[model samples]
Target: MNKTVSLDEIPYSPDSCERFEALRELPGAAFLDSSYPHSSSGRYDIMCAQPVACPEQPALAATETAWQQYFDELRRFHKDYYGTVQPASQDIPFCGGLLGALGYDGGNSLNQVSGAPPATRNSGGHLAAYNWAVVQDHLLQRAVMVAQPSMREADRNDVLSRLRSQRRVKHTEFQLGGKFESNFTESEYRSAFESVQSYIHAGDCYQVNLAQRFNAPFTGDPWTAYRQLRRTASAPFSAYLSFENNDVMMSLSPERFLSLHGNHVQTVPIKGTRPRYRDSGADRLAVEELKRSSKDRAENLMIVDLLRNDLGRSCIPGSIHVDALFEVQSFPTVHHLVSTISGELSPDRSAYELLRDSFPGGSITGAPKRRAMEIIAELEPDSREIYCGSVMYISADGRMDSNIAIRSLLCTDNDIRCWGGGGIVADSQWRQEYQETFDKVGKFLSVLEEMS
Candidate 1:
């Protein structure tokens, strides 16, 4: 059963960002913000909290069996409660189901094909069973609180009452204690770039993405910082997730890893990039430059080909193709060359199966995904953790959506961390490639640093 409570009944303004205020302190909270400007259609913001159950995390999955078993449980749990339930409407992306970030390392544990370094942490990955979510539809200029049949009447009413109140609670102000320190200096990054080039020249992989981590001490809740970043650089696939163990993630990702609506699936991989400029002419030039760069096009094609192969595992034969290529999209901080590839999901396959077959998106890994993984593991010093992973959701009606965890930040143990990197190809210069990493995340770091 699906219960839809209109935004009017919540007593807050139709466009108030505080509509979901009740979920602020709730455990297992997750917000998928579409931030679709101009009040347009084609996107919806979904948020939920207080998961009924979640897998053991930070050490839960030690092997492939453990990984499959947990997901299997989620399938059964959702099926039992939401099998007959559906999204309130076609545009709603989620309607009470599994919602959480699938840390990048989650795939490292589940993937038997990666001959590269095995999952180093031995403890990562989590998915939560959510019974309710507030869906904000910008197109309709309306919102709905959809609750699952599995939830008790008392619980649902309690949630409704809280929403109607629209009570505001004071939160600790978030501040960076100091400037973020990088794990790699210029010389260190150059060394990694050279190694990746050697791998490309040796035919180990076509291109490998290497990254550097930056961290600084911080105090207060990450929610404040997330809001600040969103105000400046909010993306179509942005998300904020707060979990136990002081684990919090704020992702302002512009890359769509995968999305499924019934049998149709699509992926938009971002490849080339150039920073935005304040001058109108300079900005236009940057976009034009990204559009015509041959080296960037070549790099983009390698990942496109890699992803087409990945989708082949579960997509119907003869149904996969590149719908669009070399399209340039301008964001607040940069212009990116993105390409769309889509396929029809095989009738025999489910959404999670498709996800399993194509985890750790190929765009992040290089061509010949296995060898690229090994190269990446050998080059980057620390584990990627959630970066390059995904913020994903599987709905009761089988709708699915996820984002590549680039331009992401994490708060754990008073340490605030974020990563920046890009695909490195044979012709890529070490200096430009190194700077690209910062260009990807530099603005985000500035937002946090300003809070100090």
Candidate 2:
């Protein structure tokens, strides 16, 4: 009923992006990238498209039961395709199931089961039950193409041929019309910061994340912009998703919201950040500063505790534990203090329930999630859309992984938008916090402008 073929004919390239370039033209093309030279946090690249079944919820089409309806559809798809499926071989992490984005609004709604006002804007989402995926396991130095159900031999041959073909597809080049413009000006951001401080002082919440959006006019292929961005902003959880509406979502997120393999679960939250510097000495100093900052450590601890409670809902009692805390991770443009928490999922729990119980990742939402979200909605000028959402894969074999979509860009209707933000706490300074947002996305904004 399933089909899988080794792609041994295709040469292994460290640059996974090159392998995905040709596949980008395929219908429903979606790439879950580990990038080239891969990050310490990632070891595989899963590229898939041509889903057998895919359910999508538009952002503007959200309702109280909208997220529930979408999940029901996803469950139906899984039951039909993956109810009796098997995982791919060669140590591949995914054998194909649900591959898509969950909108921020929708993810945020899950934790608001009681006494919360309806979301100002509902989250739109997508989950496709893909029968096949081209999986690259860098650690094993192997490549595999696995398809389930009826992938005819002819179809297999055609896909393999296209993959081995040279990368020469040309589309309109992506170029920004100008430098990006922010939704929050300096004064506006300052005012929001003061408001957050007021809430903290009033004991309304421990911390809240405030984000500002940036937009630039652009022309040409969205994939081109993603290609350019992956070189610099790429992280362990990076992804590029192409929609039929010609909408493109590019996520260079470094935060892992959740991962499930068998009954084991893990989540890594990133909280503290320091910008990268051109000078090696200055960069080292920044790393040391982040490692030593009491404010940063306290903020990280709050999110860790928040997630412990969230995961507890679906995890076996007393099985949850913090695997690591306050670990420093360096990326091309920033350094982060990341903490990992793991648990053994209750046998009665499904990955879907786990996701539902813990969506939109607490690191991005801050402590006391519901109240923090209320504060965010009151302050942020626009709906977050999919910016703080997730790009995930739930494999047929029951393995799952997702990224807290940050340092992300959404391109549509001749407009490109990206977001950057940080957690605000009692001790956080407004001006420095404002600049921190820029530090997170400075590379992405600058690179697009340079191309123009």
Candidate 3:
């Protein structure tokens, strides 16, 4: 059986970021910090440490069968509490991260998309590892200690006390040791852009998101870099994960891949983009221009339709509908056209099943999702790993929330890597699309430059 022990409330403070920084020192730590806490419906700031459970290997394939097997194993390991601690209408009871490359196995016919053989680097797995931990919910000022039924009360209290006592530390210094390199050169990217356009003209796919990876040798505190990233590009679904063996993930993602509350599921796909202007007037104009762009509207609508179809597979018939469309949301570095699609999940479906149907969000993959993945694989030089993967939380009672792993960074023993890209339609400009990728990642790149 599972256990939930409520402890003394941590003093609520606006500056939870400091507390989050302090919590990162713990093993297998993860934090989800909200950019707009007051407006958020669920727990805004959550910090979890010392995972009592985790998967032995990452879920690497995006195939439904693979995911089913992976989930089966995960459920097996946590059998004692598999169906306990039901969602309390407002509680999120688990913590985990979903790697982006899982899309490769999610029933897409991309087996022929060629690239260099998959890198042997252990960039964490493509699947999420759910762990029972001591979780701090800053919004409710509550600390929930989830442990095995056998864990003693005194131990739970000790863990809660340590979490309450954590405080922000002085930022550490990091150095970017060498010049960063892109996996694809400008000409090469342009060539890929043309290839995607040709596919569009051939009626193969309407839109395809093409991306390039950037990497540099580095040696520094990843936590410090994550702190800088938070300050530079505070996003609605920001996350930080520190694993054993020096592997780290820092995500400041603004897109919501999926969320499940009760049997209701929602996805917010982001399609359009415009760089934020420092000048107030210019910024207003940019937002207006994006709002009026027909091409962007079309781009967003196509994905909205795509997600509607994906959700329909698992949702009650006639229950799937668009909640919002072409809404412009501004982030620290860019403006985006975001749309919300929601549906009531079929009664028999579990959260994992919902994810299986919508493994990769449509906004990132483009219209006719399968064809886009094939093109992405054929053109991109390496496996995306976690770049476009998801960082998510799945509650024990089957609640879940996930973010498309955009505006993210990965750290290994010697190198730091990040990726940025946009969806390509026939009307998309190669140069502008190239610039958009940089614009999307500009602040993150700036942070790296400052550290270098």
The Cα error of candidate 2 at residue 425, in Å, is 0.7
Computed on alpha carbons, the lDDT of every model, listed in order, comes to 0.80, 0.83, 0.72
Clashing pairs in 1: 58-123, 59-123
Best by TM-score: 2
Relative to the true structure, candidate 2 reaches a TM of: 0.93
lDDT tens digits, residue span 15-43, model 2: 77777886877888899988758476568
Give one digit per residue, the lDDT tens place, for model 1 in 1-452: 44442222344234334655577667787888765662222267887888886445434346777776666666666667566664567866787788887777776656643433334331256578888888877766677778776677887777787777746767679988899999899999999899999888997788888889999999998888887887788688888887678688888888999999989999999999999999999999999899889999999999999899989998999999999999998888888999999999999887877887788898887877877877877787777888899998988778999999998988888898899988999899999998899899999988788877
Best model per lDDT: 2
Those runs of model 2 whose alpha carbons end farther than 4 Å from true positions after fitting are 1-9, 38-41, 55-66, 113-122
**What are the per-residue Cα lDDT tens digits for candidate 3 across 33-79?**
67534324335666666555445543343344555566556555544
Which of the two, 1 or 2, has more TM-score?
A: 2
What's each prediction's clash count?
2, 1, 7
